[model samples]
Target: MIEATGLTKRYGKTLAVDNLTFQVEAGRVTGFLGPNGAGKSTTMRMILGLDNPTAGQVLIKGKRYRELKDPLRTVGALLDAKWVHPNRSARAHLRWMAAANRIPAHRVDEVLDTVGLTSVAGKRAGAFSLGMSQRLGIAGALLGDPEVLLFDEPVNGLDPEGILWIRKFMHRLADEGRTVFVSSHLLSEMALTASDLVVIGKGRLISQSSTKEFVSRATENAVKVRSPQLEQLRTLLVQAGADVTDSDDGVTVSGMDSEKIGELAAANRIALHELSPQAGSLEQAFMQITGDSVEYHTGLEAEAQHVLEPTR
Candidate 1:
């Protein structure tokens, strides 16, 4: 397990991360999510001891990262796939890391095979494609056979097949009772992959909860009702204390479930055309939750209006 308490970082006048406290439990895939410029990378660096915190500290398995006897064996991270020596072969890179950590030379081959880079084991790091480079990075991370793994955008430049493989691979790691902490901007994938989420915005903790609970809490559950007597049904639903929003062909009822809506419609003798539940998506919930924490705002609507205004 990874625990951070009052983790804070600063660079001159800029406060990167502030009093961030969270835990990544074992045997689960925990997604670290935040908007751009939200200090995610900085926090990861601090966790890895790449950057020191200004105030607080983070511990990996109850020990600070720098205090570990063999840091790589305790925590393996793939922050940058391009962190390899350009001239080194995939096998050579893993061998170097293994040698540094006193990991057996045979373990390099094992991890190389594990990441499916055994075929390209002899290829120079610089010549490898983005997908291949990512695999090589994963190979290095696994070389130490660490119990805790941290991956930052591991599938950033991969094809669909590669993405699926990494997703399944993370699942396998978690299944083996390892702590897997992944940071990615892919909300949809997180919804499918991570069981728990550590969500932050503007260098502060926003929420830490199960993926299901986060989505349900951040987004609304509504039922869309379409009927021949739509206006009458709307009146009845409003009177029944459901928040009703008019649509072109139906009314959306919130603070109520589809079953209740259907029962109410049936009781009023309303001929229903459709009663569909609008379950909120991870994207919708993310947008709603992180609306204010975005570092940059386009304000595109205002720009468009200015363009349309009559020139003086």
Candidate 2:
């Protein structure tokens, strides 16, 4: 398990990470989420001992990363897929890493096959495409068979198939009781892949909870009702302290659940064609929670005007 206690970092006058306290339990995929400039990368670096924290500390299995006898065998990370020698072949890269950590040479071939890079084992790192580079990076992370893994945007440039592969691979790691902590901007994929989430914004913790609970609490649940007597239903729903909004075929009621709305309609003898509850999606919940933490805002009109203006 990974634990952060009052973890904080600063760069001169700017604070990069605030007092972050959270735990990434074993046997689950935990997503680390944040908007741009939210200091996610900074926190990950601190966790790996790549950067020194201004205050506080992060521990891997009850010890700091620097204190580990064999860091690779304890915690595996793929922070930057491109941080490899361009002249090195995929096999050569893994071999070097294995040699550094005293990992067996045969284990190199095993990881190469595990990441499906055995076919391109002889290819230079520079010649590999983005997807292939990511695969190679993952292969190195698994070389030590670490119980903890950290991946930063592992699916950034992947195709649909590659994305699916990574998702299942993370799940498999968690199933083996490893601690899997992934940081990504892909909310939809995170929703499907992560069992829990750690959301940060502006160098501070925003939320930490199970994926289902976080989304449900952040979004407003509403009930959609469709009926031939739409007008009557709307009137009744509004009078019952529910906010009603009209749609093409129905009305959406908030401030109440589907069960209450259904009972009200039934008692009023209103014919109902469809009544369904609408739960907010992960994206919607993310936007609602991080709306204020967004560092950049784009004005559509300003952008359009700027684009339309001719320049030298």
Give the root-mean-square deviation of each candidate in angstroms. Answer: 4.8, 5.6
| Candidate 2 steric clashes | 0
Q: For candidate 1, lDDT tens digit of each residue in 1-312?
A: 999999999999999999999999999999999999998999999999999999999999999999999888989999998998999998898888888899999998898888888888998999999889888888887777899999999988888988899999999999999999999998888888899999999999999999889988877788888899988998988898888988778888888899998899889899999999988777667766776787876788346434433235
TM-score of each: 0.89, 0.93
Per-residue error (Å), model 1, residue 229: 6.1
* Window of ten residues with lowest summed lDDT in model 1: 301-310
Residue 259 CA displacement from its true place in model 1, Å = 2.6
- Model 2 stretches astray by more than 4 angstroms: 300-312
Expressed as tens digits, the lDDT of each residue in 101-211 for candidate 2 is 999999999999998998999999999898899999999899999999999999978999999999999999999999999999999999999999999999999999999
Model 2 scores a TM of 0.93
